[model samples]
Target: MSERIYSDYLNEYCKDSSIFLVKESEGRVKNFLNLDQEIPDQYRWRFSDLNSIVKQVRSENTRQGLNKIYWTDQSRNIEAYIIMTWWRGNELVRSCLNGLNRREVIVPAIAARSLLELSTVFLLNANTLEKNFKKIMFPPETIVISTDIENLVAKMIWGTRYQPKDELLTQTNIMTALKKLAKSPGTKDLMPTYDFLCDIAHPSFIGNTSYWSHIEVINPDGSERRLMSRLTDRQYNTEITDKTLWALAWSSTCIYNAFIIMRDAYSGLLKKI
Candidate 1:
C-alpha cells in the first residue's frame, strides 16, 4: 500500500482509543530532552552534537539557500532534503508520539504508524550517514558498531553475500537488523516487546486490528457477518495503560537521542556550502 496522511491514520485508529491516556504522554516528552539539566555535568550530548552540525552547515554555505531543501522539486537539494527528512521524520515522530500518548485509546494503533515513520528514518539516516561518513566525523567506535551489526545481520539473514538483500529501505532487511540488535545478550529482555511492537508497526495483518469488527449475527444461510463496529467497552476516559504510556515516552526519547549525530551533520551541510 502507498503512504497515508496523519489524519487518515487518526480517524481510523483513534476512534476506539483513549484520549486521556494519550494526553498523559505529553508530560513525559520534556524529560526525554534532558535527564540532568540541573547538574554540573549535564548529559546533553545530543545537544552538543546538533550544535556542531549547525556550525558546519553555516560555514559551508555562501548561498542563502544552504538551508533550502527540495520539498517539491525533488531535483534540487537532494542531499539537503535527505538530511532534512531525517530531521523532519524525527520531529514528526516526536510530535506524533506525544499526540498519541495523551489522546488516543488504543495506543498501539498510533504506535504502528510512528514506528513506520521511524523505520524509514532509520534507513535514511543510516544510509545517509554511511554516504557521508567522512564528513559526519562520527567516532570510530560508533561507526564500527553499527556496520558490524549490519554485517552480522546480513550474513545471518541471507546466508552471506550469495543471496544479498542489503537494501536499506527494505522492511525485512531493517527488521532483521533491528531484531538481531534487540536480541543481543544485553538487550534480550526487550525482545518480546520489540517483536510485538514490530508487528504493530510493520504493514501486517496485526497492525490493522484497529478496524476489527463485531460478529454479532449469523445470516439465514449461516454466513458470518463482520459488521463495522467499535470496541466500545474497551474505550476509556482514564489514563493510558502503563505499558503504552511508557512506550510512547520511550520512543520519543529514543528518536530525540538518535538525532543528535544526524542533526550535527545537517548543520554541517549548511556550513559546507
Candidate 2:
C-alpha cells in the first residue's frame, strides 16, 4: 500500500485559519494542529469558533438521530451508543471552551485530557466499524469497556442513595488507546499536547506547586536557597493558562475531526443495514 499523504486531505478539509501547515521534504506539508504563532486574539475567538463547528455538527447529528433509528436489536444498538458518545464529547468540548474563556486552570486541563481521550476513542471506533461492518453484532470492545466503566462509576457514586445495578467490569487503560492513536498517521502529533495536559491534569508537581505562588526560601546564613510554594496563584499564572488554552484548542480540533469520522462511518453503516 502507498503511504498516506495527509496534506492533500488536510488542505481539502481543514480551514486555513484554524490549521498551520509545515513544509516537509519533497514539497509535502504536515498539519500542525494549532496556530503557527500566537495570534492577537488572546481571548481565543478562533478557538471559540472551532467549538461552534463542533456544536453545529452535533446539532446535525441530533437531526439524524431523530430522522430514523440506525441500529436495531440485531445490531445491539451500536448507533445510539456511538452517536450519544459523540454528543457527550460535544458537551465536554463546550464545557472546556467555557472554562477556557472563564480562565479556569485545573478544570480545563482535566477537561482537555478527557476530550483528547474521547476523540481518539471515536477515531478508533470508526476504524473498527469500517473494517467489521458485516459481522459486527455490537460496537467495538473499547466502546463496550468504556460504557461499562462509565456505568460502574455512576453506580459506585450513586449506589448508596439509589442502589444502581452492578454493572462494574474492567476499567479502560487510556495509555493503550493513546498508543494506538500515536500509531496513526493523522493523529500522532496529538500525543505531545495530550501528554502536557496529562501533566497538568494529574495532581503532581506541575499540577500543584508549579501553578501556585512561591516564596523565597532563605538559608540559615541569610543566603537565598530556592522558592517554596505558598498558595495557588491566580494573579500571575500565565504558564498554566497559556498551555491549557493551547491544548484546549487542539482538543477542539480533535473533537471536530473525530465527529466527522464517526459521522461518515455511521452514514456508511446506515446504507449497509
Best by lDDT: 2
Which digits, one per residue and each the tens of the lDDT, describe model 2 over residues 118-177? 767666655665555444333322111134333432332233323424424333467887
The whole-model lDDT of each prediction reads 0.43, 0.49
Candidate 2 segments whose C-alpha is farther than 4 A from its true place: 1-71, 74-76, 134-172, 186-189, 213-239
TM-score, each model? 0.38, 0.52
Error of 1 at 205 (Å): 10
lDDT of the structure predicted as candidate 1: 0.43
What pairs collide in candidate 2? none
As a TM-score, model 1 comes out at: 0.38
